[model samples]
Target: MSGSETIGSYLNRLAAGRPTPGGGATGALQAAQGAALLGMAARFTTGEGYEDQADRMERIASRSEEIIRRALKVSDDDQEAFAAVAESYKLPGETADEEADRSEAIQRALLGAVEPPRELTRIAAEVIEMCAEIVGVVNPNVLSDVAAAAESARAAASTAIVTLEINIRAVDDEGTRDELRRDVERGEVAVATAATVTRRVRDDLAR
Candidate 1:
């Protein structure tokens, strides 16, 4: 990871024959972009005599950046978890008695696959909430960028929820599947709430 590494380059490398930096990494990148936009709004607002709101904007900017960094790290974690799951699937099971071992391995792998996107949805929702809070307060000149951040956050949340649901569907354990289904439902509600907030903020800025 060079300091000059553009996101496109990073994503290209991840998408290459490498197993890491899959959907989780891509979702993180989307969240990072949103964070960057929020930071931009903060910077603009802080500079243009909006000193009264600077502290709040600064907090939002910091939180957004932290979320982006965490999301990026989670991408690597997701890849590593997936690799571990793959290794588990390959565990020696030559005997009929190994059935339990195989089942355990499969369960672990399913859990690994479910975790990354679950984290993604949570982070995306956080970013959205931050964006909503800062939307109308930021420099009006940068309202479009704020909107972009909100939209990107919403997209990331939606994508993450879908990924989680797909992984959940692949799990063999009914209990785990049901738990994941509930998570999916919660994610849907969060995304809808975020979308509504984004829309209201955009409308307020328009006014």
Candidate 2:
């Protein structure tokens, strides 16, 4: 995206008949949005009356920025990874040697496709933890924003798990598959924990 494309332009590209900006890229973008919300919530909590929590909020803001920046990078990486996958599928598959080469390329590309989403999963978990930390401690005025952050982060983690599962199914190496499975499980657990905390925030907001 070159970091300069408008939101509408990006969405148009995503909606077009193209495979580059697929599910993995979208998952990273969602995580980025969640991180942004978390940062905003922390910003609201850091001034004047909230002096006691200033340090924590400042840390949260910093970490949240890093997470979102990483997510943008992940999005770009995922697009490139999937583009490679699409190209690999187009490799010739006529003779025995040709078929074998095509298969090898596809396998390698599939493995490459798993990486960006896995990194986003880790980042989303960190964002979820930050949301949990600031839920009650953030400015009461932006409690809804904090709650939204938790929900958005949970959604991002959940999406990463789905993307991981799809890619891991095609993985040939048992060791690599096991590692991917562990990552997916970790992401699932992180989302579940975020959901628990978000429910508390929701209940409190309701009261």
Candidate 3:
């Protein structure tokens, strides 16, 4: 979607019958929102005595911007891959040769569907870690925003991981499955990081 598009419109499209902008896309969109919140918090922290940390904040902001863009594209890629998988299933398979071709196409499509969510899980985890760092450095007034960002990142990472896990099951290649399993393990660590960060945020809010 163009940067000019409204979020409401996107949500409406998501709710529509079309499957292009599905759960994986939503996960990416949520992470982008989290990234935007993190950038907003970082923007508030870049001044006065914070000059030393300003550079780090700028770097985070830049990377978050990139991630946001990539996530949106991944959202589109995920749907295209999904469509490929669905269409592959429809390929004619009455004959032996047709069955072989259809099977090959489906397997390739499954791999295609597996990739975007895996990348999304990885990036969302990084965004979550960035939130953990920002929670300490951001102005107290915007602490709540950082907290929201962390929560969103956690949800986004978790969602993408679920999508990844689901698609991984259709993949018959043991090597690819093992690699994705490792990615899931790493994503679980990211979820733990987000939980720890959120716990600190909760503590701060209580105090």
For 1-207, candidate 2 gives per-residue lDDT tens digits of 547889999999999988878778888888888899999988888768999998899998998888888999999999999899889999999999999999999999989989997897898888888888888787888888876877777777888899889888887888989989999988988888788777988898889
Relative to the true structure, how large is the alpha-carbon lDDT of every model? 0.76, 0.86, 0.85
For residues 11-73, what per-residue lDDT tens digits would candidate 3 score against the true structure? 788889996778887888888888888888888888886898988899988888898888788
Candidate 3: TM-score?
Answer: 0.95
Compare candidates 1 and 3 on TM-score and give the better one.
3
Q: How many pairs of residues collide in each model?
A: 0, 0, 0
Q: What is the lDDT of residue 161 in candidate 1?
A: 80
Question: What is the C-alpha lDDT profile of model 1 across 118-171, one tens digit per residue?
Answer: 787777777777777777677878877877887777777777788777777678
lDDT winner, 1 or 3? 3
Off by over 4 Å in 1: 1-5, 17-19, 92-94, 172-175, 197-207
Q: After superposition, how far is residue 80 of candidate 1 from its true place, in Å?
A: 1.2
lDDT of 1: 0.76
Q: Order the candidates by TM-score, highest first.
A: 2, 3, 1
Model 1, position 55, has a per-residue lDDT of: 85
Candidate 1 least-lDDT 10 residues: 1-10
Best by lDDT: 2
**How high is each candidate's TM-score?**
0.82, 0.96, 0.95
